[model samples]
Target: MILKIGKLFIAAVIFTGISALAVSAFAASGPALFRSEGCIACHTIDGHGGSVGPNLSHIGSQRSLSWIKTQIVTPGAHFASGSTVTINGKSYMAIMPNHKNMPASDVNTIAQYLESLK
Candidate 1:
């Protein structure tokens, strides 16, 4: 009976390890989604993308998950008056085009990726 119990415990441990790995893999998908979705066209990640939007090197440390999600969905709704951004030597009104058409799952994945930037 003791040997059987030990085997069961070992099996449980291995299962848990596999589960954790799977979760990590899922979380890592966020970055890929961000890139595939063209977020890099306007935003910079770790100094690698464009500068049309704010640099997102440490965005996770600055904004909450809910705020990030909202911004992604309705960007123009949150900008302050008189706020502007310069892109490619051209200064434009600080209006983030809404990406409301993006799939919710993909938005969430990109949000997850941004949150991990911290």
Candidate 2:
């Protein structure tokens, strides 16, 4: 009976490990989704991506997750008191087209991922 109990405990541990692995797998894919959505074209996270916008290496520390999500869904909601996104030696409005077509849930995922970028 002791041996059987030990086997059951081992199985439980294995099952928990598998579950944790699955969760991490999903978490790992969050950044992939950001890339797939073309965010890389304008933003750089993790020291790789684009220079059209500011490098978001520490965005998680600078911006709240909720603010990031809202900004993703409706960009230009707030702009700095000075300056704007410069393009090709010219100043342009800080308006980011809202990807309204994207599902809110996906946007939320992206926001969470960006929030974790730091």
Tell me the TM-score of each prediction against the true structure.
0.65, 0.63
Name the lDDT value of residue 33 in candidate 1.
72
lDDT tens digits by residue: candidate 1, 1-118? 9999999999999999999999887753777877877778888888788776778889899888878998888876677535885534557577567888988877888887788788
lDDT of 2: 0.76
Clashes of each: 0, 0
lDDT of 2 by residue, 1-118 (tens): 9999999999999999999999877653557777988888877777788766667777788789999887777675665423476544556457466777877778888888888876
Question: To one decimal, what is the Cα RMSD in angstroms of model 2 from the true structure?
Answer: 5.4
Query: Which of the numbered candidates is closest to the native, going by highest lDDT?
Result: 1
Per-model root-mean-square deviation over C-alphas: 5.0, 5.4
State the C-alpha lDDT per candidate. Answer: 0.79, 0.76
* lDDT, residue 21, candidate 2: 93
